[model samples]
Target: MSQNAAAATAGPVSPDDVAGLRAAVTGPVLDPADAAYAAECATYNLAQPTAPAVVVGATSAEDVAHAVTFATRHGLAVAVKNAGHQVVPSVGESSLLITTTRLTGVEVDESARTLRVGAGVRWHEALAAAAKAGLAPLAGSTPGVGVVGYTLGGGLSPLLGRAHGYAADHVRWIEVVTADGVIRTVTPDDEPELFWALLGGKGNFGVVTRIEFTAVELTAFYGGGLWFPGEDMAEVLEVWRTWAPALPETASTSFAVQRLPQDDALPAPLRGAFVLHVRFSHLGDAAEAEELLAPLRAAGTPVLDSIAPRPVPDIGAIHVDPVDPLPYVETGFGLREFSVETLAALVEAVGPGSDCPLVTVEVRALGGALDREPGTPNAVPSRGLPYVTFAFGVAAPPDLPFMDEHLAKYAAALSPWTDPRNVVNFIAPDEAVSEAEVRRLYGAERYHRLAAAKRRWDPDNVFRRNHNIRPSSAPAGD
Candidate 1:
């Protein structure tokens, strides 16, 4: 073994030792003194601070393997950051960070309708590349999110999700470097176990280096937004629930009730007061899409209507999720069915009459594409929930405690309707749900197997920042 490796094994390697290790890797190595360290650590979401003991700007898979080897040898923790949208804190504390942002590249095979993307490439980057070949992947509303992170977390896309399914359903293969510092190519045919684990498994199994997936031929959607006045809350919620399920598979929609902060950047009508914003996307023609959405559109005289035939990349404008980073507290639950009674309860809790001045209340219909089994053999616990509803609480100066209380009450009120199954993407840090709740999110059999997989792949519990599954031998209730 080398002197640096021996020294690392003995104790925490000093800064000089880290420099020696950096000399071995091909990528840019950053320490505290590095001028670009702060900028490099900043995420797109801007909420997360990527303060790492060491940051490796991985330009290739080989570079990642080197970082992994170095981290494992020194008994250091590791965090893989791409777009940094998952702003949960302490995620990258005193650990070695492998930032994949520089690895942004995309390649498309037109005839195969498949695209291979670098781990750091964002959805918009891949979409632009795929569009050249008249193909598109099942991208989410915000195209700025990294492809590897979103898809690995069971990507919930806006394009034809009902008819097709989640973005994870279309994955062809992935290249990952395991915690043991071994580089492996994962496909359903090759390492079926790792392949299944990597999909919807978050960053538990390994650091994904490359992702290959099939794309859709879609160019445009008969989609856009419908805005309603604050007074139409009761009528709009009831009308949306009744009319939403009846719509065909070619359609997907979300109802967002929010009080847009007064800003000169936004239109006057939507600036201050609460508003019911209904956003929809259809696979077919513009006119038929309009007619199908007419009733909901006519539910209330709109303050603003931007609904029309537009490019897929522009879909983020429909929900118009706040681009700026602000302290946010969110809670979400998937329901088997949002019955009329339950809808009424929700309307009372966070709707127009409620004192909750929320940032947004979003309800996404999750049956079509998200309901089906993924192409790869993975342990995606089926929650059997038809709709997933969430409350994003963003207050001035960000009231963490109040936000938590409000969301807990909201989840409790809907407990009767909520299915235990959780999409890993929606799992937040402050959730007080029990182990039984987690078991409910992921079925009994699958959760057990995932725990088993964790035992085999990551025995020491190195990657426990995510929704963790403890090993069987670890004392239960200790």
Candidate 2:
């Protein structure tokens, strides 16, 4: 049947369609009744449920191409899932989801100082592989996040970001299966516009199978976190707000106000209590790092201090973000500056005395290398923004009804300092982001270019499961 005819039928997918896909691809095909269907469709963000009509476990680029071609031929939308860390709902009930968990491969070249990683490869695997060669790829705080998805959203690494900018800027090339079902190698020289779109465009244009990027040398850095009593939140944040903007590019830092569950699983100092965590990472010697951090340390007595020299693989320790997947709601906004008033507003909303249900609220300092443009232009937007304020609340079944209002109250409190533009990587799972919001994420010019590229590469809008960029010729509502 032709794609148009198949789409017009609009009934449940038949067994014949699944069988056809299974025959065309080397990987396994899963339907609702399949034994592995649930596991294959599980996502890291439990709040965002995925109920795809079919799931394809893609093992290679050829597998990805086959799946894309099959989906197109069957008139089904395609959604790609790697580590399932994406907060946005990429896969839906009627979609054909391609899971890249089996594409776990990594190659590190010490001589070239570059890492080639498959779509399934997470930061931990890449970090371990690069560590063996005395190098490290720019990765996020959570090591479990898939490298491709994170980098495509303009990965803001916990460390080295102030020195090296975003991970996307370091990308050398990518191998993607576009909507046309062709396996193409994209780079600055090979499909310049597509390459630019892929850099920070998320999964709008195509499905990436593998990515290669320049890795940095030096396997160790001086970094970690300092924990203060909840009563000292004001003092800690004050010191951080003043000290952060003055630091050199070698230093990157963020401060979080966290209310931990009173459970034995947490450390004694942090168990069942609210505390202020001052996380810092410096790409320098211990003495230099200490000198730069002394003022913040002297602000108040710390209950726990873990700052010291550490190997590159231990970079995740800086933020100490939760490694395991759980249900939560996250939201954030960019800030042009963080003044005393902004800090006060934050304290009033989610601070020590506030009856906030949020697990953590943080503001990361942005600037330094992040403000500078890359050698090659990419789609990463709002680089000039100076700070990003984010907060997350652990979702309990009872709280689901009020979670949106609860989170919105806190976000509104910070509105005076918050900018409409936010980092694409930090968009929350439940946020009802619209096309105008997406256009603002990328500036007007970059958005237009991205739309033009989408028109050229995916005019059919087959890859509409992400922070979508509609084709130029499409109607506004379409």
Candidate 3:
């Protein structure tokens, strides 16, 4: 028998009983010898990668359940990773890391317009499946993120969320493994309160194994980016702020300030300089889409323009989020309105005059379809914001102080229109944005109700990671 097997047979499982549990798991139970162990644990931001005691390569839902049960039995903390894109380093040291990179499954129901996806499934997989059935889900700008993780955090898709609300709003059901090692299927119809809390409440309640959500009848869209020189960003942004909210449900847009490396990978005009990109996703006829976007496109000398009808899967090319891993910090706030004054302030903060070599500053317009309340049970409560602003700083060195200063200036500039509350998913792991901020973003009533439900289902606080939902103090024990 292996050392792990011998340890198991010895009996009396202690806090040092991981070797024994490793003996039981069928897949490769890693302990640093695995070459990809370090790389696998490295997240998208690439700043931190916790050294877990054992990395469990889960092959199926049963495998996931086994890993969870084993961790609980052995008194070992556990973390679930899919695509390892967690902006926050939730997975920590000596933990049993359940790597669900193998569960690739998708079942589409055309009549119901829903797709049941495995926890490991990526956006590209779902996008292709939906497109085949003349349907689409609210997917993020990039198609590389895991479906379950993103949806559970309330996915904001590029396909005009204003008309569809959030990706979480469409979820019909979820299969999860609780801390006590029970696999349960939850839906609004079944566990109504649990269902409501898990949608936007993050991974505090349980480990979501599968996701089922609605898809729209969209195969292609009038989507692309129009680039302008740095000098003209001011005029272009002003036009975007004035026109974006007035846009119909068929139109979704954002203004972006980007500094691209002079490389062949980037389009010719966007290379080697600070540029303004007005990204668009329109569902209307080509002629009408052009007519609506003419004012802003006409505002400056066009360096590059690629707005045209394209399949939805290729939408990543527009935002062009870095595919390669690098250290980065993301901080954002929701704006009540992106007025002309607000636009000017933002331009001054991160535009041409700014010293930051930031990857991008984006202002996503969010009123049309996104503002409407969903009839479903979920937790993306910030509906009043006309725009959501984000700053992604990539050039900051390890242990850099300049990053803090840049973010401070950017925050100060937009302070007038900014909401005190911000999304939990966007905050850096190191920064303390405060629970009060989260409550403000989620609202007192919803936060309170979510806390209550969290207590009922996860009173022991076993599943605590991601944007954690703390149990209420009323019930100390179940």
For TM-score, the strongest prediction is 2
Better of 1 and 2 by lDDT: 2
lDDT (tens digit, per residue) of candidate 1 on 205-296: 77898999998887777777878886787888788887888888888888887878888888787888688888888889988898899889
The number of clashing residue pairs in each candidate reads 4, 1, 3
> For this target, which candidate reaches the highest lDDT against the unseen true structure?
2
- The Cα error of candidate 3 at residue 13, in Å, is 9.1
Ranking of all predicted structures according to lDDT, beginning with the best and ending with the worst: 2, 1, 3
Instruction: Provide the TM-score for each candidate, comma-separated.
Output: 0.92, 0.96, 0.91
Please give the lDDT score at residue 9 for candidate 2: 44
C-alpha lDDT values of all predictions: 0.75, 0.85, 0.73
Better of 1 and 3 by TM-score: 1
Query: For candidate 3, lDDT tens digit of each residue in 269-346?
Result: 767778988888888788988888888777887788888888878868556677877776766887777777887788
Give the better candidate number (2 or 3) by lDDT.
Answer: 2
Which window of ten consecutive residues has the lowest lDDT sum in model 1?
1-10
